[model samples]
Target: MAFSGITTKFTRSLVIKMAAILKDRCLRRIFKKIDFVRKPLRLNFVTDNGQHSIDKLLVANRGEIACRVMETAKKLGIRTVAVFSDVDEQSKHVKMADEAYHIGPALARESYLKMDKIIDVAKRSQAQAIHPGYGFLSEKPEFAELCFKENVIFVGPPSSAIRDMGIKSTSKKIMSDAGVPIIKGYHGNDQSNERLKAEAEKIGYPIMLKAVRGGGGKGMRIVWKAEDFDDALESARRESLKSFNDDIMLVEKFVESPRHVEVQVFGDTFGNTVYLFERDCSVQRRHQKIIEEAPAPGISSEVRRKLGEAAVKAAKAVGYTGAGTVEFIMDKTHDFYFMEMNTRLQVEHPVTEMITGVDLVEWQLRIAAGERLPLLQSEIILNGYSFEARIYAEDPDNDFLPGAGPLVSLTTPLPSRLVRIETGVVQGDDVSVHYDPMIAKLVVWSKDRSSALRLLTHSLRQYNIVGLSTNLDFLINLSNHQEFRNGNVNTDFIQDYYNDLFPEKKSLSPDLLARASVYLILLEKRKQRKSFDDIISPWNLSSCFRVNSDLSRKISLNDGYSDVEILLSFENDDSFKIQIGDNVMKGFGNLEINGSQKLLKVTIDGVVSKLNVVEHNNTIYCFSMEGNYKVHRLIPSFIKSKCEAMNLGDAIAPMTGTIVKVNINNGQTVKEGDIVMIMEAMKMEHVICAPKDGLVENVYYAVGDTVERNSVLISYLKEDEKN
Candidate 1:
C-alpha cells in the first residue's frame, strides 16, 4: 500500500508541471503577436523626436482655408483656435473654432498679414502650432522663422524653403540647378527701368511680365508688343507693390500654347518624399484658375513620370517639407517648364485628394507632428478622375470682373458622399469686397472623366443663387463645351472659345415662361394664405381674379438682356392657359413647399417639368434642367425705354473701386475708344473709355477716392448742350 501511494504522488506532480509549462508557452506567443502589431505612438510636433503632444492649434488665416484646417485638427482630437479680422467676425471659420480672437481690421495688410499680431494670438491662446493658410502670410519666411523662434510649430515647409521658393528669381536658379526645365527668362537682381527694358528687348516682344513675389494672377501681365512694354511694366509694378509689397519684375518668353499643370508633393523630416499626382488647372480667366482636374487627362505615362520626378527634385532641392505644389507650364508637345513652387497648400488641393483618396490636410498635420509619411511613392496610386469647379461671385460675360454683395437666396445640390461643396459662406452671408470673391468650390468624382463631367453639369444646374450674379451659367456652358469635354484644355480656353461658350441671345421657352408665371402666382397665393386665418383659403386667387370665369393678365419676364410678354388666363390657382408672344400653351402646376424652398411640379400638355424656385423682393428666380431664369413681377414700360436709350452716354464705373487715375476733366473733348480714366478694384485695373465723341460734362471722382459700382465717373455733354 505504501509503494502505490508514492507512485500516485509522483504522477500528480508530473501532470502539474506539464500544465505550468503549457501556460508559459501560450503567454510567450501572445506577447510576440502583440509586439508585432503595436506601433510607437508619437506626434511630429513633440520635442526630442515626438516625446511631447500638441494640444491646441492656432489658425492665422481666414475664410475657407481656416475652416479646412480646423476640420482636420478636430478629427485628430486637437483643439483649434481662430483669429479673425473685424470683417471676419461673423465668418464661418470663426463660428467653427473652439475659441476665437479678434486680430485686426478688414484690410488684409492690417489684419491677416500682420505676422506679429498672429504670433501674439497664438501665444495667448496657448496653441502649440500656427497654420498660415495659402494667402496672406503663408509664404512669408519671416513669419515661419518667427514661429520657430517663439517655440511654436509652423504648419508648412521650413523657413529656408519658403524663402528660397517664395522669390521667383531664387527658385528659378534652384530649379535650373536641379535639372528642372526652366523657361528662358531674365530673373535678375537689376530693377532699373533701363535694365528691365533692355532685358525685355533681349527676351523679344510678347514677353510675360510677372512679379518676382506674386500670386493669385496678381502682378502678372502679357505684353504683346514692344510699344506696350512700358504700360504693362508700370501696371505690373503697381499691382505687385499693392499685393506682395515687392515691385521687382521678371520677363519671360510667352508660350502661346501653354497649359497649367501642377504636381502635389509631400515630404517628411525623415528625408522621405512622394508625389500625390498631378492636377490640370488650365481653364482660367485673368490668370486665375477656374476649373481643375486630377491625373491630367490625355498625358502620356512618360510625361507624367518626368513631371513627377522633376517636381520631386524641385522639392528636394529646397529641402522642402509638408504640402507644396510645383507648378509647370507645359507646351503643345508636353514639354514642361517649371513656373514656381507654392510652399503651402494650394487652393485646388482637393482634386488631388479626390483622385488619391488621401486626406492631405491630415497628412500635413501628421507630418508637422513628426510622423513619417503615411504613403510611399509606389503606394500612392491615382484611382478615378476628379474635377473641381470654383464658383465665384463674378460675371463671366463681363470679363469675369469680381463682384461682392449679399447672397440673398442660396441653395445647393443635395449633398452626397461623392459630391462636395466647400465654402466659407452660407445663405444670407455677404461676399465682402475686402477679400477674394470666390463663393464655393464644387467638387465631383467618378470612375472616369466623362462620368465626372456629367455629374458636374448636373450639380451645377441644381445650384441656385439669387440677389447677385454668379459664374454658374458660364460653368455650365463650359462643362458642355466640346473642347472642354474632349480634354483639349489650355490657359486660353475661355478666350479661344468665347463665341461658342457665350452663345447668342437666348429666348425663354413658352413652357419655361408659363412655369415662371405659375410659380410666381403660387408663391403669392401662399403668402396670402399665411397672412389669413385658414390654411385652405379660396380667396387666394391669381392676379386678375374673377368668380367662375377665366381671367387673363399680362406678365413680363426679363433676363437682363431681353423681355418676354406672357398673357396668362387663369382657370384656377393650379391651372392656366399661357400665351408667350404668339405661342400658346396650357399648364397645370402645383407647389410643394420644402422648408422655405418651393419646388414647382408643372405638366405642360402632359410633359412634366420640375423646377426649384425662390421668390425674393418681387423677383422670382427659377432653376431647372433647361437653365435658370429670373423674372421681375413689375417692369414698367418707361424703364424698358430708358434702358434702350442712353440719355447722356455717361461712362459709369463697372464696379466699386478706387479711382487710381482720372485722365480727363470737365470740358475736355473725348472721342469713342479714348481712355478717360482707370479704376482699380479687387486688385485689378479697369480702363474706362468714352462711349461717343462729346465734351466731358463732369468728373465726379479723383485719383485716390473710392466710388460705388455703376457710379457716373464721367458724363458726356448732350449735343445741343455742349459749350
Candidate 2:
C-alpha cells in the first residue's frame, strides 16, 4: 500500500509539469478545455475484431484543404505528415505539418497523383491513416482501395461509394432508383453521334451537354439553337478527353434561372446517417462558384426537409461512411432535382460548420476509426447564418481569366470568433501556373442573413492584396448587389445583373488622387530612412520643408479605369495640398508600417485605411478600401504618345496558358471576328479572335506551346499597310 501511494504521487507530479510546458496562455486554456474530449482513442476505438490506432496521419494533398485538415488533426493530438511537389516546398501546408517529405516534380501528374509514391511515403513515415483532402486523390476509388489493402485507414467513404458517385451517368441512375427526383437527361450507354443528336432533338433546343466525368465547369457546354449542336459537342468532347481521358457525355434540358444548392451528409460504419441542412452556391462566374452561404434563404421549411431527406437517402443507398455533399438544382417552383454527389469534403464546408457548430474533419477521423457519430439527427443544431467568398488571383474585367505571379503583399482581416480565414499562400509566395490560382477564402457569421452578408461585405473591402491581379473588387460588388441582398439567387444571377454589378467606369476623385500622392511621398521617405547615408539628407525631406518655398510637382495615378495627373504642393512632412484637373484639396496623411512592410496603416483626411503596398518594376501599387492604384512619381513630356505607340494591334494572350490550336497562319487575311487561336488554363478553354480586319503577319506560337500573359501571339499588319 505504501509503494502504490508513492507511484500515484509521481504520476500526478508529471501531469502538472506537462501542463506548464504550454507557453502560450490562450493556447494553454484552450488545451485545458479540450482535454476532456481528448481521451485516449484506444479506449473508445476498440472493437470485437481489434484496436485501430490513428496516432499519425498522412495528408495526400496540398494547399488550403491540406492545411485545414491538419488543423483539426493537431487539435485532436494526432501527428500529421505532409508531401509536397518541387514548387510546393515552401508552401504554407508544408510548414504546418509535423513532418514533410518531397514527393516529385512541380506537375501534379508526376507528384500528387502518383499513387505508388504517396503510399511509399506513408509507409516510411509510419502513418496509421491517410487523409486525401478534397481534390487531387480525394475522390479516386483506387487510392482508397490501396490504403485499405496496406492496412492504413482511409479517412473517407468506401471505395465502392466513391466509384458509384464519381461518374455522372452512374450516379444519376442510382439516385433515380433510390426514389430521388432527377432531371430529365440522357444517361444511357449510347455514345454514338447519331444517338446523342437524336436525344438533343427530343429534348429540344437550349440543351445542356455535359461530360459524364467532369467537374469544375469543364467539359460542359450550353446550346441555344440546333445549328450550334455539333460544334458544342466536339468542343465538349475535346475538353472532356483532356481533363478525364473520357469523351462520353449526357444531354439534358437546360433549366433556366435555377439556384444551385447542396446538402451536407455524414454516415458511420454503424449505418447511421444525418444531413446538415443546405448551402446556396448560386453566385458564380463562368459556371464556377464564387460565393456560398448556409441555411439557404427564401425557402420554406417543407422544401428544406425534402432536400435534407433526399441527400440522406442518397448516402444510405451507397453505404457511404464519411462526409459527402449532395448537390441539387432548384427551379422557379421550388422543385429540386439531384445533380450529383461530391463524394468528399467540399471547399465551402466552413460555412456549414459555422452554422452547425461542428468540426467536420473531427467527425471524419472518428468515423474512420469505427466510432458512431457523436451527434444524432435530433442533436444537430442550426443557428445563425454564414457566408464564404472565394478570393482568386484573376482579373474580373478580362472575362474572369485566372492569373499567376508572386504575392508580394497580402494582408487579410485577423481571424476571430466571428471570422475565419482559410488560405494556402503567404507574402512573397508564388501563385503557380501548374495549379489553381485561388488565393484564399474569407468567411463570416452573424445572427441573421442580412447581418452576415453585411459583415462579409465589410471584410472583403478590407482584404488588401497586391503584386498580382485579383477579383477582390468584383466580389465586393457582388455581395452588395440589391438582388443578391434580397436572396433572389439563380444560376443566371451574374448574367441577369451584369450591368448593375459592373457599372460604367468612373474616374478617381481629387481627394483619392491627393491621398495617393501623399502615400507616394511617404513611401519615398521610408526608403530614405532605411539608408544610413541618407537618414539626415535634406533631399529626403518634403519638397516644402527642404527648400522652404512653393514646391510644384506632377505625378500620375492609374486604377485600371482612367489615368489622372495630380499637381502636388507639399504643405509639411505629414500633409499635402493637391489638385487633380479642376478640383483641389488639402489633407493630412501619415503611414505607419509594420516590421515587414506588408501592412501599411494610414489615415488620410481623417479616414483611416489599411493598405497593402508593393514596389515592383519602378511602380508603387497601393491596395486599400478605395481601390487598387498604381502610381508613377515622374511623368514624361510625351507620355500620351508613348502610351499610343504601345498598342500594336496584335492578338495577345489574355493569361498564362498552353496553346492548344492555331487557326490562322502567316500571310493569312482574317475578318474582325475570325478565330485566331485557342488557349487552355485552369481547366477551361478560351478563344482568341482577331481585333480588326487585317493581314496576319505571323503567329508566334504553335500548338502545345506555353505562353505568358499580354505576350503578342499573332501580330497583324496595319489596315492601311495591308493594301
Error of 1 at 165 (Å): 1.0
Candidate 2 ranges with C-alpha deviation above 4 Å: 1-51, 525-550, 558-563, 570-576, 596-614, 623-646, 717-723
* lDDT for residue 650 in candidate 2, whole number 0-100: 84
Clash number for each model = 4, 0
Residue-level lDDT tens digits of model 1 in 166-219: 899999999999999999999998888888889989988878999988888889
| Number of the predicted model whose lDDT against the real structure is largest | 1
lDDT of 2 by residue, 240-344 (tens): 888777899999989988999999999998999999999999888888899999999999989999999999999998999999999999998999999989889
TM-score of 2: 0.89
Candidate 2 at 264: error in angstroms?
0.2
Clashing pairs in 1: 43-369, 44-369, 44-370, 45-369
Per-residue lDDT value at 244 in model 1: 85
TM-score per candidate, chains pooled: 0.90, 0.89
Model 2, position 358, has a per-residue lDDT of 81
